[model samples]
Target: MEDERLYAWGNPWFRWSVVSFVVLTVLSFLVGFVVLPSVQRDYTAGGIWASICRAAGLPANWGAGTATDKAGPLSTSVVLAPAMALPGSSDAVGRGATIALQQCSMCHGVQGMSEANAPNLAGQYPEVVIKQLEDYKHGHRIHSFMEALSSNLSDRDIADIAAYYDSVPKARTAPARYSESSAPALVRVGDPLRNIAPCIGCHGGTDHKLGAP
Candidate 1:
C-alpha cells in the first residue's frame, strides 16, 4: 500500500502539475517584483517612456512631468513669470483688442471666447499665453497660422495680447456630464494598460505642468 501510494504521487500528471506550478510561480515573481517596479519608474517625468515618445516623434510632455532636456535653449531662458507681469492697462488692452479683432476674432471671439475651431483665451494665465506665443514664434511649438502671426510680434505685443486675454472673465457653461465621483478611477489613476495617464496630472489642480495656469 505504501509503495502504491508513492507511485501515485510520482504519476505523470502529478509531476507535470508540479512543474507547471513552479514555472508559473517563478514567472509571477519575476513580473510582480521586477517588471512592475521598473515600469512604474519609467512612467515618471523624463523617464524611459518620455525618451521613447520623443524618439517616436511625439510630444514628450503632454502637460505632465518635467519637459525633456532636449528642448531648445529658449525654453530655459523663458522664465515662468507671474501672470500679473503685464498689467492690464487701458493702452495695452486697447492695442491688444485691436490686434485681436484684426488677427484673432475670426477664430477666437471678440471677448476671447472660443469658436468652433479655436479655444477660449479668456481667463488664461498671461505667462501661459506668452510662453505659447514665444514657442510658436521660435518654432518650438508648431501651428501654421499661429507661427505666422506670432513670428512678427515683438515681446511687448505678446505681453499686451496675453494681458488682454487674461483680464477677460470666462463665461460659465453647463457642468460636465461626468462628475469626479462618477469617474474617480479614470480621473485619478488612469489606465496603465492603455498607456493613458491621469487627466488631472497635467491639466489642472495638483501635479500640473509648468507654465500651466
Candidate 2:
C-alpha cells in the first residue's frame, strides 16, 4: 500500500503537470522581464528588433526619426510675438478661416480638432504655429506633405492661419491622477538603464526645451 501511494505521488501525470508549469513560468519570465523591456528600449530604427524585421523583408521606416532629422533649428532666439493683434478681429479671422478650410482641414480637421492620424492644433500657441509653418516652408522641415503644402504660403498667410488656430477655444478635461497608474513612470522617471529621457523634461509644463514655446 505504501509503495502504491509513492507510485501515485510520482505518477506520470503529476510529473508532466509540474514540468509544464515550470516551462510556462520560465517562458513568462523571459517574455515579460527580459524580452518586453528590451523591445521597449530598442524600438527605434536602429534597434535590434528593427534590424531583425528589416532583415526579414519588412519596411525600413518603422519608427519616426528625431526632430533634428526632420527639421533644422527654428530660430536662434525664441520669439514671443502674439499670433494676432486681436483674436476678435473679424477680417484676420475670416481670412485665416478660409485658408484653413481650403488648405489644412483635411488632416487637422475643421477648426483644428485633428483627425485619426493628426494632432490637435486648435488653441495651440501662435508662435508655435508660425515656427512650424516656417520650418515646413524652408528646407528645415522634411515632411513631404507639409513641405509641398507650405512651400507656396507667404509669411502673411502663415500668420493669419496661426491667428485662426490660436483664436479657437481649447478643449478641456479633468486632470488625471498619475499615482493611480504606471503611465507616469516614463513621463516622470525614465529608465536610466535604457537611456530614455523623461517626456516632461523636453515637453512643456514643468520644464521645456528652448524655442519650444
Candidate 3:
C-alpha cells in the first residue's frame, strides 16, 4: 500500500503554492515600486528613478546626485572659548560700566537687570555675552538694532561690556514652583528614542557643558 499524506515539491499542490507565492510577490513589487510611482505628478520632474525612490522610502534627491544645503542667514557662527570666560581687569570693568550706562541702560537697566522685556545680563557668563555680541556684529544673528549697535563695537569694547555685566550681582528670585520630583521627562531623563540630551546636561544642574548659557 502507498502512503498518501506526505507533501513535497513533487506534489502538484505544493508546486502550485510555490509558483503562486512568487507571482504574487513580483506583482506586489511592480505595483508598489513601478506602476504607482509612474503615475505621481511630482515625481515626473525627477523622472522614473526619483519616483521609484519615493515609493521605496528613499530620499527624492538620491537619484539626482545633489548635496544638502544647510546654510541660513541667521545661522550662528560664534565659537566659544575658555579665554572668553575669564574675568576682566578693573580697567575693563570700568570701561564696560561706562559703555553700558551710556548705551545699554535703556533696555538692559543700569545694573544689568532688566525691568523691561529685555534679558537680564547681570551675572551672565562672559563667554555668552561675547558670543552673542559677535554673532550680532557678523550678521549671524539677525536683529536690526543689535546688528547696528554691535557693528560699531570693537572686539575690545565687546569684551569690556561683557566684563562689566559679569561684575554685576544677579537679581535674587524666589524658589522654583516645581520640585525635582515634578520635573518633566524631557528636562530630567530626556527622550532616549529621539536622541535628545537632558536639558541639565548643558544648562547646569549636576554638570555643565561648555559654551551653554
Candidate 4:
C-alpha cells in the first residue's frame, strides 16, 4: 500500500520537474542571445558568442554572421571635412566636416587614409560602426588611443563619426592622365609568403589587400 502511494506522488513530481527544466532552458537561451543584454553588436559578435558556446559543448546558432546590429549609436550631426574624393560632389556641409578633421584624422588617416595601423573608417556600414565603437569602449578592441578616443563620445558623436566617414569617396589610385603614355606597368608576382610552401600565384590585383584605397 505504501509503495503504491509513493509511485503516484513520484509521477506528478516527475512531470512537473520536466516542465520546469524546459522553461528554464528556454529562458536562459532568450537571455543569452535575444531578450537579454548580452547580445553583441558587431560582425564578429556572433563568432565571439559561438566561441563561448562551443567551450561549453553546446551547438551554436547558425544564423549569426548576418544579424546586423544597429541599436546604439544615436543619429546626430557631426561636422566633417570633405572626403578625399567621395562620389558625391561635397562633404558634410558646415562645421561638421571641420570637426571630423579636428577629432578623427589624427589616427584614422587623412580622409581615412592615414599611415597609422588603425583601420580605415570610410564606407563601412553603420552596424559595423556601432560594433567597433562598442568594442573599443568595452576593452574588446585593444589599443592605446582607442580608449581615449572612444571614451566620452556620446551616442550622437558615434553616429556622426560613422556617417562622416561613410560619405568620403575611395582614394585615387590611378596615375594622372599624363602618365598614360610613358608609364610602365609590371605584373610579376612576388615570392611566396614566409612559409615552406608552393610558389604563390597572382592573376590580377595585389597579393595583399592593399592598393589605392
Candidate with best lDDT: 3
TM-score of each: 0.52, 0.51, 0.60, 0.37
Question: Each model's C-alpha lDDT?
Answer: 0.70, 0.69, 0.79, 0.53
Q: How well does model 4 score by local distance difference test?
A: 0.53
User: For residues 106-198, what per-residue lDDT tens digits would candidate 3 score against the true structure?
Assistant: 977899766665677888889989989999899887788889888999999999999999999876654334356878878876789999987
User: How many residue pairs of model 2 clash at the backbone?
Assistant: 0
lDDT of 2: 0.69
After superposition, candidate 3 runs with Cα above 4 Å error: 1-52, 60-76, 179-213
Alpha-carbon deviation at 52 in model 4, angstroms = 30
lDDT digits (tens) for residues 1-213 of candidate 4:
866755564678766877899999987776665433333443244554664565455644557785665687543333233442233223432233465687778866757655655556555444456556666766666666777778877765665666666676645444323232443233232334643322122122221123222
Alpha carbon lDDT at 30, candidate 4: 61
Better candidate by TM-score, 1 or 2: 1
Per-residue lDDT for 161-185 in model 1, tens only? 8888878886665433446677677
Assess the local accuracy of residue 87 in candidate 3 as a C-alpha lDDT between 0 and 100.
97
Candidate 1 segments whose C-alpha is farther than 4 A from its true place: 1-77, 83-86, 179-213
Worst 10 residues of 1 by lDDT: 204-213
Q: Write the per-residue lDDT of candidate 2 for residues 1-213, one digit (tens) a residue.
A: 866855574778767888899999998766654566456553454655655554456765556662235565654333556533445366766888899999999988797776445657778777778778888788676779989999999988888888888888765754434452655788777779999986655443321322233
